[model samples]
Target: MDRVLADDLHALHSLVSGLRRDIHAVTAAFSTSWSSGQVEGHVTRVKLLKRMGFGRANLDLLRRRVLRSP
Candidate 1:
């Protein structure tokens, strides 16, 4: 990381810096088996459906769409 940061010509400098800033979280993610991937996927799916439906979808329609989605 230091080597990459030290090299002015390196394209990875910015990425390395970001990784350094969030090193603890990055390491924890690698070390831990627990994750919110399923919850996040559900949230993303719901948000996409809401966006697609926009002002036309009612609560029941949205509920049905969400329930029916894979």
Candidate 2:
């Protein structure tokens, strides 16, 4: 990181700074097997469904769509 900053590659410098700021998370991501992939997928799916039904979907319809979704 010091070397990167010294090299004055502004783009890489900013990226390294961000990685340094979140060093703990960066290390944990590399070290951990656990993830929120399933939860995130569900959230994304629900958001997509909601968007698809935009102005017309009521609670019941949304519930049914979620329940019926694969």
lDDT for each of the candidates?
0.92, 0.94
Q: Provide the RMSD of all predictions against the true structure, rounded to 1 decimal.
A: 3.1, 2.4
What is residue 10's positional error in candidate 1, in angstroms? 6.8
Q: What C-alpha lDDT, on a 0 to 100 scale, does residue 23 get in candidate 2?
A: 99
lDDT of 2: 0.94
Number of the top-ranking candidate, with TM-score as the measure:
2
lDDT assessment of candidate 1: 0.92
Clashes of each: 0, 0
lDDT of 2 by residue, 1-51 (tens): 899999958889889999999999999999999999999999999999999
For model 2, what is the alpha-carbon lDDT of residue 60?
Answer: 93
